[model samples]
Structures are given as structure tokens and as C-alpha cells.
Target: MKREGRGEQSAGPSRTEGLEEAVRQADPDRALCAGFLPASVRADVTALLAFHTELTRALAPARSAAIAGPMAGLIRLQWWRDVLEGVRTPDHALAPAILSALARGVFHRETLLRVLRAREAELNPEPEVSPWRQMMRDGAGGVQRAVGEALGVRDEAVLTRLEASGAAYGAGAMLRHWPHIQQSGRYLFPGETAALRQEGEAFLQSCDADTLPPAGRLAALPAVLAARDLARTSAQAGQPRGLGDRLAVMRAGWKAARMFQKSGEPAL
Candidate 1:
């Protein structure tokens, strides 16, 4: 997983731009997908992704230690949970935008809480693959559904497909991050790398991207890119970095847009 940055610590809306930029830098894959969203909701989608970035980064310091590190991460997680629950006003720069999205009903509050809880599970390093699997399903899967809903996908089948594809991408990402995470003395998905990789591949094999609606394809685009990387790399390989990653995302987006355009659906 990419390390999340400590975005501008300021509280007001004035610093929102800086925090959003930091999120863009830290989570380029989702941010790149967000760019393909309709202009009406593009910024809101980025705000939702910013929340994801904050949760992932919160665990950075804890990756090196077992107990105490996770404890510290829990405190950070609680602050976010409380902020979302309205128990306290947000003290972070990205909060305003997130709150605005919430106010506009971009995604349900309970759904976001599920994502938070899923991430909370990540703080405690587990020896079994089940915990990590649940994390990906609820964490990344929930995020894709939320973003898809924000993009005007209302069908339950489409939402389910989005969730499945996103979870597969999460599995791929976990595979990519396994080596680096192990170096930190933590085993997030201990002993199941091969099984997980197989699971992701199976999911992708069944997911026909050409049949998905344009919005659904965009929602699952990261997984498409991840599948390509997995095709050429080993279980321990890292995701495409920097320029290569950007070009890969751009090419995928263009191809997807063209496909949808040919089908008479709106282009991505």
C-alpha cells in the first residue's frame, strides 16, 4: 500500500486545495479514476478518496511495531469515526470537503462507517487471510460502491459488480504490498499470497469489462490496470510506478471511453 501523507493540518476550507493535492499524490490510481468522473461530481469524488487516503496513512507509523503502533493508529481512527458521527467537529483540512459530500448525500453515512471499521481491522496484524480478505471486501469494495453511486449507478447488480471488481483490485494491491509490509515486521495476510493471487485472477477472469456499463467500467478501472500488472509480474511485484503508472491509467481510460462511445453510452 502507498503511504498516506499528513496533509495540511489546518482546519478551515482555505487549505482544502493543498490537502486534496496531497491526496492526489498519495493515491494516484483512485485520483486518476476520479478525474474521469463527470465534472459535476469530480471534486466530491476526490474528497471521498481523500478520506480513504487518511485512513490508509493513519496506519503508517504502526506498521513497524506490533501492539503499541496499532494502539496509536486506533486513536487516529476514532477521531475520524467521531468526526463522521458528528460527535466532534473535524480538525483536519480534508474534513470540510468530506462533510460537504456527506451533506449532499454522495454516499450513505453507514456505508462509510463500514469502510472505517474495515480499516480498523487492518491495524491489528493477523496471521489468517480471512481478516485481510474482509478488509478488502468491506474497505475497497465499499469505496467502489460509494463512488459508483455518486457517479449515478443505481442498479443493485451494477453496484455488486463494482464491489466485486474493487475487492479484486484490493487483493492485487495487497499482494503487491505484501513484501514491503513484511519488511515492516507485520504480516497482513500471512501465508496466503498464492491463494489470494489466484482468487484475484479468478475474479478478473469472470469479469468481462466490455459488458459493464461505462460508469461500472470506470468504477472498476483500477482493477483492470491491476490485472494487467499482475499478468506480467510476480505475486511480489510492485505496482507500476510514476510515469509508467500514469501512462497505463491514461491508456486504460482512453480505451474504456472509446468502447463505451461505440456502444452509444456516454464516454468516460
Candidate 2:
């Protein structure tokens, strides 16, 4: 994570701010909704999101000399894994806060393990489609699940929705990165783009339509962004989002907040 601390002070960034920066970079749409986060578990949720970003970037394909490869990613991941599992405690920006959260059962070793596995797989995944989707599910779903857990949600049905929402988030990532991919002069997508769109939509529709609790909706709001972008992609293939599209993201956040405030259902 070469990103400098933007929300921090002289010594270092606060744990929550560190996480907020990560989300702001990884998916600005999600950052737009950070104001909707309830204060109680904000730190925990942000830390989980930030940690997931770290894993994703660690193993990301090297598009430049600056980009780290699988071996470097594995070392960083091992540090996080050891910290989370209590195997070796180390002083770091996120370790202490994350440890405290884990102590309270905000996230378990199992989910973090799956997250690691999926991220590692991204380094060199099978050509087959099923394994790819499963990697998406494990990586994205694990992050969403952690956010939901921070909200104190334990319903199995609602938990299932988080995973689907996560998969939608995965598709949104591809669409979001399209401009950058082309700029890098190496643009490609796996499988049929239409099928990928449906995969995202199907996972989204699989979620219940009813309103969710504020924190619950906050945890699931990425699904809305995914659905919106997928719709735009299908309607106008290869169109880059403009300022209007950016404003729409902010509007969606406002509307999503209103939905939770009024009736627990998002209008977007």
C-alpha cells in the first residue's frame, strides 16, 4: 500500500482514517457512503475494508515495475494472517485495532483465511470460470460478511445476501477499473461480458428487496453501486463515466441513507 495517509495527523493516521483512505482509493463510491456509517462499529468495519484492499493489491498483476508481485503479496499477507490469528503479534497501523475487534468476535479466523486464499488465487487462477467466481465470492464475500458482522447482524438469510452483494462488488471493480486497464495498454476480460453482467445482477436480485437496518444497509450499499454500473455498462458498452455519473454516486448514497432513515429500504 503505497498510498500516503490523507486522513491522518502528524504521528500517523488513526485506524479508522487509514481504512477510510483505503476504501476511498479502492472504490470511491463506497467512500461516498462512509458518512452513513453508524459510529458504534465504524472503526471495525473500516479496518476490515482496508485490510481486504491490502490483500487485493498485494497479489494484483504487475502492470508496472512499481506494482508488487505474488511473493511480495504473500509476505504482507502472512504478516496480516499471523496478526489476525494471534500467531505473532506485531506493531503496525492496523494490527492493534484489528486485534481488539477480533477479540470481540467482529470477524473470525475462517473468513480471513478464505479471504487470503481467494486473494492468493488471484495471482494465478485457473482458466475455468467456476473457480474464478468462487475466488470472487471468497474474497468479496468475506469482506462484506465482516462488515455485516460489525453491524451485529447474525441472521443466516441476511448473511447470505452479504455474499451475493460481495460478488456484485467484484463485477463493479472490473467496470470501475476499465479506464485504467485501457490506459495501461493491456485490456482484457474473462468470459463473456454479458454473462458477467448477469452474474452480478443475479447475485444482487438474490438479495431481499425489503429495507435493511441502517448499518445493515451500509454494509450492503456496494450492491447498489454494482447494480447501477452494471446497468450503465449494459446500456452503453465501453462508455467512460463522466462527472454526471460521479454525482449520481453521491446521490445514491444520500438516497440510501434516507431509505434507511425512513423505512430501511434503499430507493436506488
Candidate 3:
């Protein structure tokens, strides 16, 4: 695997400043990903987050809603697809930061294409209520696989295991961001976010110390099951359907947590 140290100083002043500014603008909640990765990996991950932030702005909800959700999302996806297909080059909005990373091999081109395809699928998926679930699962898998491949893990078993764990973790994170998705009138599952957060916390706590690496153990320390359970229960109070929904979410989280636990330590 490539082991380059953080090389921000080697980049041009403008590029360095832009990356730093972008990182400064990054949402703290999302920035938590840094804790899960190595320093070099964090740089790439930060670049990915910057790309996502720019993408979100470029396809702002107000603009998307104006153009209509389906059409807008398709247009955005098509833009990226065009870049992947070599039909067009990156434009100003996505060019500097996102495309620069692509050029430098921070992320694979095919993985970007997969992300666009997944977004396209989400725009018009089957089983309307949960359209994003499968697309998200596949998209996350593709990116994770790309990352693992880039890291030079050729063993198929190891690759598959890493992909699965990464996908589940990605899905869990996406579940937590449901409210943002909802603003675009794209719902993955009713009450799924709350349930996922609730159950995800539980599953993390339930993990035995021996099962997790030191980093994982430290990462899991913040959200014990009790805190999340109380938050979920409190939110659901006086609403029977809310209570039921959270229970379902908790079940899903439990399943995810168990799957992640069994997947063994991440290769990172």
C-alpha cells in the first residue's frame, strides 16, 4: 500500500489553501470519519467529503426542487457520468477540488461513476419508499472496494469482507442522515433514521473488547446503548407508531452491528 505522508505543503499554495478552507467548512459530524482512518487516508477522505459538500451545493435542494427532484438528480448524475464517459470535462464548480483529486488518484474514476449511478438509481428506484437503500448499499460497496483495491489488498476474501463492513457502516451513516434526504422528498424508510441511530449505538456497546481493535474500542466509547436508547425512547414517547418504528430500526441496527462485529477488524 502507498504510504505517502501528508503532503499538503507540496501542493501549490492555492490548492493547499482551497483544501484547508474546504476542510474548515466541513460539518463536524461528518468530519468524525477522520477518527476512523489513518492520517493519509484522512486526507483522501477529507477530499471526498469536500467533493460531497460541493456536490450538495451544486445540486442544492432549492434548485433540485425547482427542476423537480427526479430531473435534477438525473442531471447531476449525468454530469458526473459525462466526466466518467469522457464525453465532457469537469466544469468550474467541480473541477478544481474534486477533479484534481481524481487526477491525483485520491479516488478512482470508476468509483465516482458508481456513485453517480447510485444517485441516478436513487432518483428513480423501485419500492419507492426505500429506493435509496439498495442503491446506497451498492454505491457504498463500490467506493469501499475501490479504496481497498487502491490499498493493494488483492485477496478476494479480505476485499469482500472489507467491502461488506464498509458498506454496512456507510449505510448506517446514511441512515443517520435521513432528515437531509427527507428534505429532498426522498425517503429511504419511514422512521428508519431514529431506529438506526438507536440500534447502532446498542450494537456498538454490545461489542466485546476482544472483538474490536483499540481504535474501534475508543471510537465506540462515545455512544453507549443506554444513551441512544433513552434518546430514541424519549423521542418516541406519546407516539405509538414512533415507538414501533424505533423498535424496527433498533432491530436493523442490531443486525448491522453484529455483521460488522463478525466481519472482524478492518484492514486499515
Candidate 4:
């Protein structure tokens, strides 16, 4: 649900310091869990998460001069699309990892683009729970689908489980991010909020932890965090903000990491 800024570790401490700070603010979930993976796996996951964070932020209502308004959002989305299309070189910080993934034939360009398009469409108001759930599905499922592919899990059933996890995570984020979305001139109806919350809980419950491959479970850390957040909050409530949310994310990451230590069971 979060994407942190990532600086190359090879960079000097000063350069990494800023990235670390930004990452801490954006994707604490990734920063905390990276240590649980092997160094090589950590780098790949970090790059994927970084690009996800960029797209997530870019899709939001622009806050600064760098990317402002709906048109700007489309421009940035197109830039990313171009990166995937290979028409233009990847010029962004996270583009390298994405390009590498592409070169290796692991990236899911269509799903990623759908994720971005879903995000772009979110600028419009979501008045119903069904439409909101659909958006959440594409946004989060896009990443999980890509992660599963990159991990080389080809079972359609397993990928379906990952999709459920992604939808659950996205729905919770929609609830948690409701206030911010409102501040950006978009409104979420109370009925829609309740629907989103309920659907998130349902999707999380539907995900059988026993169904995921070990690598797939690793790709599911965000859903784990979402389930935890849902558990800790009321059905009609938003995820706890600030410190509470941070603590919740860490707790979820810890839970997901523990799953890796188990024997033959990677479901959840």
C-alpha cells in the first residue's frame, strides 16, 4: 500500500540519506521487509516497489509544480507507458529496475498500464462501492500480478489468489486514504466507504494463505498489512493515520516475514 523512495545503496551515505528519508515517509513497508529477503531479491523488490510508488503518487491530484492537474497526471502516465513501450529511455530513478525487469521478460506491461490507468481514472469521483472496488482491484492487482510473474509463478489459480490479496489491500487503502482524497476535491459517499471497508474485509478473508507459493507470499506483504489494518480498525472506520498506520504496517510486514520461515506453506 506504500512505496518508498529508493536510492542506490552504492551511492554515498549523503545521497542515500535523502532517499532513505523519503522512503521512510513513503514506503516504510518496503524498507522494513527488504532485510527479510536475500540481497539480490531485495534489490529487485525494492526497484519494483519504487516504480509502484512513483506511479501511485503521479496518479494522485498533483500537489506541486513538477506534475500538476489531470493533464500532467496523464503526461507522467504516458512517460511511464513509454518506458514500458521502449519508445523512450527510462529517465526516472525507478525506471532502471523496471527496464531491467522488462529486459528479462518478467514485467507485465498491460497490467501495469491498467494499474496506471485505474489510478488516472480515480481523479474522477467514485460514488458507488462496486466502481470503487473495481478501481482498487486494477490498481493493486496490477502490481501483484507483475510481482508473481517476476517470481516465475505460472499457476493461474495461484495468481488468482494474489489478485484477491491485491484487491483487499487496495480497498483498505481507499478507506484509509479517504480523507486525503477528499482534500483533493473528490468525495467518497458514506455508503461507498462502508461498502469499500466491507469488501476489503471480505476479500482478505477469501484469500487462502495456503494457496500462495512462497514467492507469491513474499509478493503479498501489502495484503498482509491491509488485513492487519482491517483487523485493528472498525468496519465503518478508516485506517488509523500517522503513527498508528506506521505501526500497523510494520506489524503486517513482520507477520508476512514470519510466513517465509514456515514449512511448505506459503498461503496468505
Return the lDDT, model 4, position 254: 60
Question: Residue 85 lDDT in model 4?
Answer: 83
Candidate with better TM-score, 2 vs 3:
2
Which sections of candidate 2 miss by over 4 Å?
1-14, 17-19, 60-69, 182-189, 209-215, 234-268
TM-score between candidate 2 and the true structure = 0.76
Runs in model 1 lying further than 4 Å from the true structure? 1-15, 65-67, 205-207, 234-245, 255-268
Q: Could you tell me every candidate's TM-score relative to the true structure?
A: 0.81, 0.76, 0.56, 0.73
Q: Best TM-score goes to which candidate?
A: 1
* Candidate with the larger lDDT of 1 and 3: 1
Residue by residue across 128-168, what tens digits does model 2's lDDT show?
76787778778887777677776666777777677778777
lDDT leaderboard ranking: 1, 2, 4, 3
For model 3, how does the per-residue alpha-carbon lDDT over 126-239 read when each residue is reduced to its tens digit? 764344444643555444544544333455554444334434544454454455555555535435556555443433334332243333322222222223333433333222
Name the best candidate (by lDDT). Answer: 1
**Cα error of candidate 2 at position 31, Å:** 1.8
In model 2, how large is the Cα lDDT of residue 41?
Answer: 57
> Which ranges in model 4 have alpha carbons more than 4 Å from their true place?
1-21, 60-69, 186-190, 234-268
Better of 3 and 4 by lDDT: 4
The global Cα lDDT (0 to 1) of model 2 is: 0.65
Q: What TM-score does model 4 achieve against the real structure? A: 0.73
